[model samples]
Structures are given as C-alpha cells and as structure tokens.
Target: MYSRSNNGARSHRWTATLVMGQVLLWSCAAEAEKLPHNLQIHGFASQSWLMSSDNNVFGKSSSGSGSFDFRELGLNASMRPLPRLQFSAQMLSRWAGKGSEGNIRLDYGFIDYTVFSGETSQFGIRLGRMKNPLGFYNDTRDVPFTRPSILLPQSIYFDRTRKLALAADGVHLYGERRSEMGDISFQAGVARPLVRGDEAEAAVFGQLVQGHLAPEMSYIGRVNYELDGGRIRFAASATQLNMSYSPGEGSIHFVPVIFSAQYNAERWSLTSEYAFRNLQYKNFGAMPDMDISGESYYFQGVYRLTPEWEAIARYDVLYMDSNDRQGRKWAASGTGDGRHAHNRFAKDITVGLRWNITPEFMLRAEYHHVNGTGWLSTLDNPNPADMSQRWDLFSILGSFRF
Candidate 1:
C-alpha cells in the first residue's frame, strides 16, 4: 500500500511540473508577439550632386565640378507604452548650401494621446514640436523616398522659406473618420512659428536685418479626404503665421491657403497644388507699410516603368505679386532696385528619373529649365545683380533607408 501511494504522489508531481513548463513557454511566445507593437525605429540618409549652367543652386553648382553640398540625414523612433498613448521623436541634419549649413536640429518630438478610438473613427491630440500639414509633402518633405523627384516643386514648397513651414512648437489636435465610401481627416494646431533662422529672415524681410525676428502666436489647420484607400486624395490647408521685431518696432504677418489634389493608379500618378499668400507689414518706420499677395501653383506626373524604375515631370510657377505678374509695376515703383524686378517670379520645367536598386536604396537624376530667380537662395546668391534670367540645373542623388 505504501509503495502504491508513493508512486501515485510522484505521478501527480510530474503532472504539475509539465503544466508549469507549458505555461512558461506560452508566456514567452506571447511576449515575443507583443514586441512589434511596443516599439519601432526608422532612419534615412542621402547625398546629392548638383550642377547649373548660370545660377547657383545647392551650393556653387555653376562650377565645373558642381556642388556636392546637398546632404540629408535623419533618424526617428517611436514607442507605445500604453494602448492609448505614444511617444515619437526625430533628429535631422541637412547640408543644403548656406541656407541649412548642416545643423543638427530636432525635427519633431511629440506625445500623442488618443481620447477616443473606434472601428471607424478616432480622435487624438499631440503636444510638443509637430510637423505642419501645409501641402501634400510638407509633413514628410525631408524623406527622399517620399518625394517623386530629387527636388520638390519650388512653387509651393519653397526651400528658401522652408524653416517657417517645416514645424512649429505647440499643440495639435487631430481626428479621422472612415467609411466604405471614403475617409476624411483633419488636423489643427496653435503654435509658435520658428523665426530665428537666416532663411526665415531673408524670406520675410527680403534680407537679413540687424534686429532679429521673434515668433508670436500662430494658427494652422488642414482637412483631407481620401477615396478608395488613397487612390484619389484631396486636401486644403491654411496658416496665419505672425511675428514681431524688437526695439519697439512693428509686426509682420503671413497668411497662406493651399489646395492640393492627387490621383494614383497602378502605373501612374498625377498631383497638383495651388497656393495664395498674403503678407503685410505694419508700424515699422522708414520701411513702407507693405501689403502684397503672391500666387504659386504646380502640376506633376509620375510614371512607373517597372517595380524599380520611375519617371517624373513637373511644371511649377511662382509670382511674388499677383497684380504685378510681369514684375514691371514693381520695377517702375522702385521698391529697392529696378533690376530686382526679375526677382519677382519664377517658372520651372523639370524632368527626372528614379531607380530603386532595392527596397532600402535608390538613385535619381533630374534636370530643370528655370526662368527667373524668384526662389533663389539669398544666402547663396547674396547679390541679385549677378543672377541670370534663365538657367538650367542638373542633379544626381543617391539615398538609403532602414
């Protein structure tokens, strides 16, 4: 009887040990499955060579060797500590001639909290530095893979004034609604615009001033609609960016509204955007009280030759003053110099090709026939007297991502 009882006890102990081992194995599997949902990381790097016939672009491109001055590097990470909360941040270093100078800066750092989430709808808020949803590519403009060409359409995405439109410091609210017919989404924010860069100074004041420009409260918002899971998309965005100068002077304000649309298919895509900008200056003595409206627009098309090859074409135009499309009125009025009239508008025709060697690597080449110097960098072309009315630009770029 004792032997039988001892054997039965040993069997029960073995059963308990097997069950505990199974539980431990299942727990490890479950943890492994949840790893992907908890954290993620992404990054990209790119280098470009540029050459121009007459004008300088992305460094001294007119030289025989061209310019190897255009480079971009960025890294970003995101983590979800809870089902309804997330944290994200990115750092960027860009070397685009004198304008960017390859300074390492925080591109975006934000905390996102979802207040309500459902199968078909969701609402959330973000706090900290956030990318401004200005046009189709503004939010992800720095990422080379996201762009159709080596350079974005300058008419709407002017590199000269990129700092002001890149991102702002403050709060953003967003919402999304989905359905079988379509999906609609919106993002609105109240933030302080970045106004302390040389590029911003040149864009706003026409030149770098002795006194620095300071940021003030500003507002920005965008609404978007997508059909058939983004086969067709449309968006409208607007911003009221405000700023003031020191020494008890006056103020400057910029209000821009943008409309964007795109259509995508298996082999080709078409994209277009239009922007109207209103600028006003007040109370600054000796400086004329200026109120002007500018116009810009572009049409672009991309064709996919194969899974790895693509071609692109775009026509972009910008007018510093809608009323003075030819710049004659401003020239006659003598704003500063009559020769500066050529600085008031630009029209560009571009064609480019892209090759995706792999999912993580790409090479691209492009050419631009541009008329007028309206969007030329003031830092690179400090003296407008030397600029040519018409010029050509060629560029090659290689990019990698992970």
Candidate 2:
C-alpha cells in the first residue's frame, strides 16, 4: 500500500485532473454557443446524500442498520458536430467522506452516428468506452432517475468496469423493430475487459481468482421486447478466462447469461432479474479450478400515489455455486482479499422514495440491509468475512435531465 503521504498526493492528483476536465468541458460549451446553424450542446448534473449501516448481527438477517453514505456527481453532454451525426459523453465523480472509497475512475465516453428516419430504427456505432449490455438495466444505467432502487442490482452482475463491466475499442450494431406485442431491439460487439487498470487483485473477486474477469476478447449480445403494458429482456456474453482461471494459458471460455422482466403503468410497476455464469478450460490439468456459478433475483412494487410522490419496497438475493463440483476452480489462489470471497451467498432488502420537484428535477431516497456473504455477487470479493450477513446503506439523490 502507498504511504499516508501518498494517499494525500493521490487525492490531490485526482482533484487536479477533475478540475482540468471541467475547465475544458465548459470552455468548449461556451465556444460552441457562438457557432451558427444546428450546433447545440446540453448536459445535466446531480448530487446526493448517502448513508450505510448494519446492526452487526451474525448468521443471517433480512435488513441492516442505516447511516449517512457517500456523495455522487455526474455530467453529460451531447454535441451535434454535424447535421446528420451527434456526439456525446458523460463523466462521474464520487467520494466517500472520511477517506473511504473504491477509487477515482472514468465513467464513459462514446460517439454516435444516427440515420434520420421515422419508421425505421437507425444504424449507429458507439466507439470509445462502451457499456456491456449483459441485461436490461446495463443499457439504461445512465438515467438514474428512471430506476426504482437507489443502488442498482449488485447481485446479478455489477462488474468493476462500469455497471457490471465496460470495454475499450468496440463497435455496436443495433436496430429496432415493432410488433403488436411490443418493440424489439438488439446489439452485439467485441471488446477488451480492462477493469484492473492499477488496482490490487481481490483475494477473490467473486468466483474469479487473481485475474481479469474480462478476457483479452469478449463477445456480447442483447435483445429487448417492450409493450405498452410491460417488457422482457435477455442478454448473453462470453470471454476468455485469465490463466489463474485456467491452469494452462492455451485457451479458456466463460459464458454469462442474464434475464430481466419489468412492468410499468401510471399507478404501479414491478421488476425482476436473474444472471448466471459458467467457465471451462481447454486442457485437462491437475490444478485446482472452479466452475463458479451465481444466481440473483429480486421483486419490487411501486405505487405512485400522486404526480409528485411515490413509494417503493424491494427484496433481493444472491447465491453462488462455489460448493458445486466445478465451483472450486473459481476461487482465488490468494488469501488477502475482502470478505465474501469464499462464501456462497449475500442478500438484501431495500426501501425507496421518489419525489418530483418540477419538470426538470427529481429527488430519490433509499435504505438497505445487507446479509449473507455481504458482497456483490456480480463483483470480485477483496475481503472474505466470516460469512456473516450484517451491512447497511442509505442514499438520497437529486437529479435533472432532458
């Protein structure tokens, strides 16, 4: 670990870098305003009050203590550099007061090409940092105000890369088709998993050992069908597991499957999802390996009492197949990571509120009680606790976008 002095240095460095980015963004926006024709630029910003706590119970529990948590900042911009094409990017800055944090990082940046048409789904390719559309939520992640819970479904798949995972250098093919049942769409691409830029490896990043969950190459595909009444989504992807996952570096493959179901109307709505992973290696070796598998499911109901107010409650659970025949192959080979690395499960319950202040802004609040192994099923575990289920979190956010 870096010395205490280095901690301050790193924080200072990030602050400086963040300031520089802000300056550039603002300068360009002002300059663009002077241009003529269709030149337009727009963006939004938001902040929150976060709280997390648990009563420190043991074994199993349904809910946890709640306390003040972290704060978040986000900015998004769209520039019409040309009449037929549009460009956009978003950035996020987060902090955990009193010196606790995951780290400073980049959120996303990508360019889009749109074809003008009313009856057809246009062709577009987004290049730069890209979202891994393993499921429904991953694609709609940027719009926080549109979600039910304050925190996302950490159980199914929340890769460190972004929401579950992100990729560099990718091309996406997408189109929309409509039917009496609903509107259908699809996207597929290839990308390099780069979640471990400079961070320490988890003693066990979930089922993964001490290597990247994403491989040198990964393939992604997704489908969504929506009707006036409800929607259904499915997604799948495969990546080459790192050597630690496969004794022989010759070759390896891992597939992840995700499913989501959601229903919404003016008065009420519900949503749920499940995700699983399977790993296989090319060579038959004596090295210990695990075919780690995980399952996550949740149900939520929301009642919009009035145009300006709403209430919601949700239950979520996550479990791993680490004890299964091939589960051992996925355990990390080290012992210095976070708790939940060796455990088989984690679960939680969340309650939330949404209030509309005006057409341009909204506020959200949430409370959660975490249990079991107490880590995200979709993420690598750096610390493996004694298999206790006692953690808590709370958050409130204010946002606006168009």
lDDT of 2 by residue, 340-390 (tens): 343555677888889988876889988877765534322222234533356
Summarize candidate 1's per-residue lDDT along 182-231 as a digit string, tens digits. Answer: 99999998999999967788778767777779999999999999999899
Off by over 4 Å in 1: 1-37
Candidate 2 stretches with Cα past 4 Å from truth are 1-8, 17-46, 55-69, 82-84, 96-106, 114-118, 157-164, 198-200, 203-215, 229-254, 279-287, 322-342, 374-383, 399-402
* Model 2 CA RMSD to the hidden true structure, in angstroms: 6.0
How many collisions per candidate?
A: 0, 33
Best candidate (score: lDDT): 1
